[model samples]
Target: MDSNNLDRELVGVLFPGIVKNEDKAITCLGGIRNISQVYSNPSKRRLGLSFQPENPFVRKIYGNSKKGAGVLLKVKVKKVKEGNEIKREVVSTTVVGCVKTMFRFESMCDFQYLAVHREGPSDGPVSCCLEKILPSGVEVIDFMLQPSPLLLIPSSFTRFEKPIGYAYTDKRHPDRSSPEPGDSVHSKTRMLRSSQVSPYTFNLTNELPSEPHEVYVKQKEIKFDLHPRLIEEYDVVKKLFDERPIWSLNLIRYHTKIRLVSLKVIMPCLALYMKTGPWRSTWVKYGYDPRKDPAARKYQTLDFRLRHAAGVRSMIMSREDITTDRERKPKRSAAEAAAVSDEIAEGSVYFRRGMTPTQRHIFYQYCDIQLPEVEEILAPEPPPGYLCHQKRGWLPANTGEICRDHMFRYIKDTLFNSNNTDLKFEGSGNGSSSNSDDGGSDGSDGGGGMSDEGGFGSDGGGGASD
Candidate 1:
């Protein structure tokens, strides 16, 4: 193309493959006769139109020919039938160019090409020129064009929607109007629908490859089972057992050591029957024990007093317990409580004298004698036959030494001897010999007289040595 041609606005329609008949192809495209077929392979017949401000015709058609403009085309086809032949011809044509065409072109083509047209050419085809199949300036191509990976199209032709024969009625493309309702592009547009981007082309950097990364794994022992806390710790044990020779050796060594020490430690415990013995605690419980040590006796008394003091203090300070219990009894006003306290103080010998600081503090804090009587919380006496150092107030003191003496006697009988005639070996032998003499007198001889004489000579020699 020359400088003049470049300066002027130019529009090119690309018919993808070879055109077998230029006249037939031009005729098919130049009028409405091929509108249905044109819509069928819409992307194959792509259009690239230029909008240059220098072109006076373009400037007149589109108000601002400087930046952007729109174009609309309308064509009428007439079909005449003579005898058995039907002829189709382009009779009338109208093409409107305005700013609205730019917006319509962007929407229909994903901003990759101008508005798709199917019905007619922009003006009447009055001029014809011959040009090379491949133009010179198109030599440097950045990337190869292919259909979307998601959508698989075979060799057969498929119909795609294309908006045709537009009129310059509005500057904005109508969003409600769609040729194929469900055929909207699922992929991103060539240019973002933002004004900041170049609407004519796409940015290559944004389409970089995003392959997934491999995760790192730690090489550690494999555990077969999940623990209580779901942690894997004993994995090596299974592996060790799998090694036959190693596991056999380990088992032999462990069992031999266990057997060697087993009898020495276990026999005495079994003989003593310690496993079946009752357990005893060393901790102490208190009542009033005269036999207890002075320190222990003092400790028990102090503990009892402190517990009593705490119960009194709790009754004074706790609002819930005091308020609930007061409602159950006859209600007494503050004035009546004061009068009773004064009367108690005046009449009682203990309160008539001058009070110590502690006694005076207790009297005022616990409402003096106006306080209700508390139930006696007595401790239960320990059972009889219990062996302890403590003494109950009314029950007998523990005579644990008697139990100890009985245990010693039982041990002596088990270790040494028990008096029983049936258990004596010699006594049973003597009784059996005496009973046998009385029971039987007849005797039988099995050896000869010579054999008996030989035995008598051997017995005489044994008696001589003794």
Candidate 2:
């Protein structure tokens, strides 16, 4: 509370953990304790000391001193037993001034307070005092107290390898039938032999008989002289070379339309055409416009429109439903639509028409389905009275009768055509009647021939052979 005390430097003591002698002491930042006030009288030229007791003497020293002042004291540290543990306690002894008289002041005073000031604590009790006091100018300096050497309490000793009461056996052991020490065995008679033995020894000794040299026979080497002929002369070889162009041509014809459907199909076809030449032309030819065909065109356009609408709808409905009924439903977006379209274009869709039974079989093969089951399910029953003609490969002699028979039989027997109640022969009341000009007669005699084509010579052949 005193303004003079405010100008005075404050100082406090610290007990550092560890410090080398050359290291500068760092200021201790902590609460003050063990506050002591010192007053000097000019009459006696004597100093008086008064202190407030605190748990660590340094805390009180720090509290009583001015802001910055040189505090000198000899600290006595002792580790005294408290309860079951020994904890350190520090006691501070401050020297106010040199002793003017030897009269006793208090019962707490000890001979350690009589020691002269030294830079640090000495081994024995030494006398010390504060002198040369100033009113306002005071420099604060702290002596870092050294802590007592750490005494390590002994720990209970433990043995790392302790004896166990029971003996342990290994779980992994060979079976009883496995080879053991001192077992008599023949190498050749063993069921299994070591791979180290030579395999050739078994073949030489076990299988063969030794024989003496036979009578001498002269060996002759026969050689035939061959003259090379041009490969073009062999019809088969020449045909192979010549057919390459035809194959390439057929490929071009068959694959031109197929290429429009998929590049995967197109690329292999192109490679085959390039390798085989013109032979693929007939197969690859696009005779009819796929889009112009009425039935196929309508179906394709409807399919395309439906796919596009579905894709648009999917793009619009992009949110995934979280409810249980719709949790597993796929999220629809542009990318998903594109993926679905790609799958559809890659896979085959069997349209209702334009496919023969053989073509359907091939399609099933393309789809990797078994064909035998399909054949069994769709097998047709033999027509009445046609059983005898079927084995001989002969139809009725009349052309009209044959056509009439096939149309009626196919309509009656086929599952697809059986329900067509309006089925009838076109342009004929009697389906068995022939409408040809010769009335079903074979035209060998030329009954309606134009006059001998201006009369050729009838004797023997008169035309020039050349």
Candidate 3:
């Protein structure tokens, strides 16, 4: 019954050591009220008489065979008490396992091993035993599953120091009041060969504040000649932003033939990368507001799926038997597939699919993952973006969604949090607004926050303003 995992009224049990087949499967095991003698009576049956079943007792129960089996139950007390009085010495029977039926007409019971308890105990590490599991952590099953590519989400979204998933994404705009501490890889990158580009140049704000392409593309003429190629690339980036308020790395590099190394320096000044919502991983201009621009609305939000396929299968075998991937990915050769076919026929119940959100709310009430309550009335859009952690590298199930998610988030954050234009507006209105304000004077709202170094927002704008 466990092998098939179905429900039925009757089944057959094949006990080990017995040589009987289907024909000889039927046997009368005497119980407290035997029905055999009553059916054997030669007299006519009485009209008013009723026959109710009693507790079944079958001896010589072949315990080993799995084909036809009955449910086994163990009662610890194993005795019936009389009216507040003892009857005789009590001998309790220990039921080994629970059984289910293969079919309705089954004469022999089809049984599978199931440990039925009033309440499930907490899980822990233990050993195995062929006999009953006398204590914790012991199991009849052999070796456990090893994760080949276990995947999780929290680690990917980790912060460097301060407890913020949001962090320094762009060097252009640094947070003012939050200590404005910034992380830099320059110390290490500067050590690299001159030809190599830095994985990071400098960024103090996460998801660089967004702005209008008109305002975002404005460039400052800095005299620094440390890298002459950077000036050439910066000019080209400004031109591209003129076409659109947002641009991803590939879109910029592929079309303009810009060196990625140059982009590492240029991008932080031009735009902020979103980590969640709508424009997930894309880089939006510093002054472009997608929220107000109907044309940009389409790029602000997107929808997709997130699936967990890494550790779905739970079949355990010897380390040697695990020749290929633990999850059996990559399509093993026919022989290898066939060899493990019969072995891993049964799937684990732990990963039951098609479960409703309501079901999960109940199942995972105490778990780290929980489904938030749904609202019949839609709430206004606010932009947003456990356990048993075995130490192993876990590959995400699908990457397309990851890219989409990042792009969406980039757009959303750029649209909502970015108000670069306000700084420009304030500067221009005061008339003391420096020349740097010209970069964002294109009549577009852009972000220009208080700069940590000197002028407006970032050093790039500071030099222009000065």
Candidate 4:
């Protein structure tokens, strides 16, 4: 292929490399220093290409200048014959290396290897060899090849220090305050060079505090003695809340007993997804246990529908090797079969779609189900009273809602017994012990009164004196 054809074929690749030292920065393509070096080449017989900022080739080939990020140059090499005859020709270049800037932070300079390809088909044989000269203190860490090109979002949407799964919050807004003091600020990015882009950038706070005073939620102290493992699990969940985007789906296999506690903490953001269909079809699809163990074979079968995020759709068959139809016993009579079919038709539960708010409330309560905003394993509980769905009795004629503190105290009272007697300290003297001390006891002297441990003591003496 010719040079024109090569220019027509455009290809872009991203490579991640490590800098030799943490303190030094990598020099990127089209940098002032690179231009200076190219110009300062000693040999006068040189053929070269420069992808300057305004160069059409830079925009067409690199796709993103990134302030002169991706550029390729091919330089010629000179070969001198015995009697001062010199031969020079352009050399083909591949695998260009440069320092990649970490967003706006130039201080974080790391080496990046970019594979540049122009629209082309060429197999040129350049007999003249270009001397291999590598920059000092530069090393290739790892090479990742991706078929898809990298998708770019505005830098404002993904600032350098912002949390990975959270959207950028503007601190300049007068109505909002900074995150609470205890909220963690640490975050790190994953798949820095992955070509894939997530469709959504989750807002860190779906419901912002209404006022400055409400910005900081008073940390509730867990007064009860809890298992260390439970405490650690709670911390892990809070850390997840800080790290993972709230809307992202997560699968959790949990200890059955602890599942309720986890749901209580994160139910505000959880949404359960349920799929329902004909029992016979679903059972046939998922399969039944054909094992001959009477206990295992006696289990009831129910239909379950699974939704796949990916587009692939096929019925999954069970792994049991036994032939289900052949091993199964035939029904005794047609009358009995008809009776059973009628019973099944009457007893089968039907999940009605698109229920009214009141109907949904009743349905959820009856089914013991609560679907949150994101699907997660959660214990079904009645919705919080503050979020009532009933249209008629929302505000009763003579009813008052309980205060939050009162509810908390009631829960504490129910779960805890008053051990005040053990906590109480009694004095030996009746005067101090029986009556409240208002800076004086009725029968004690005005000065230093009787010491509780020392028994009856006079104002200036150990025993009663004149």
lDDT of each: 0.25, 0.24, 0.33, 0.25
Encode model 1's per-residue lDDT on 246-314: one tens digit a residue. 111112223332231222222111111110001010111112122222222111110000011111222
For candidate 2, the 10 contiguous residues with the lowest summed lDDT are 297-306
Off by over 4 Å in 3: 1-224, 301-466
Give the C-alpha lDDT of model 1: 0.25
* Candidate 4's TM-score: 0.15
Model 4 lDDT at residue 456: 14
Q: Across residues 281-361, which tens digit of lDDT does each residue of candidate 2 receive?
A: 111112222112221111110000001111112222222334552124456997667554344211132222221121111
* lDDT comparing candidate 3 with the true structure: 0.33
Error of 1 at 311 (Å): 96
Global lDDT for candidate 2?
0.24
Q: Which residues of candidate 2, in runs, are more than 4 Å off?
A: 1-261, 264-416, 425-466
Cα miss at 171, model 3 (Å)? 20
- Local lDDT at 147 for model 2: 33
When 1 and 3 are scored with TM-score, the better candidate is 3
Error of 1 at 181 (Å): 30
For candidate 4, list the clashing residue pairs, or say none. Answer: 8-119, 9-118, 9-119, 9-120, 10-119, 270-372, 270-373, 271-372, 271-374, 271-375
Candidate 4 off by > 4 Å: 6-8, 13-76, 79-466
Count residue pairs with overlapping backbones in model 1: 2
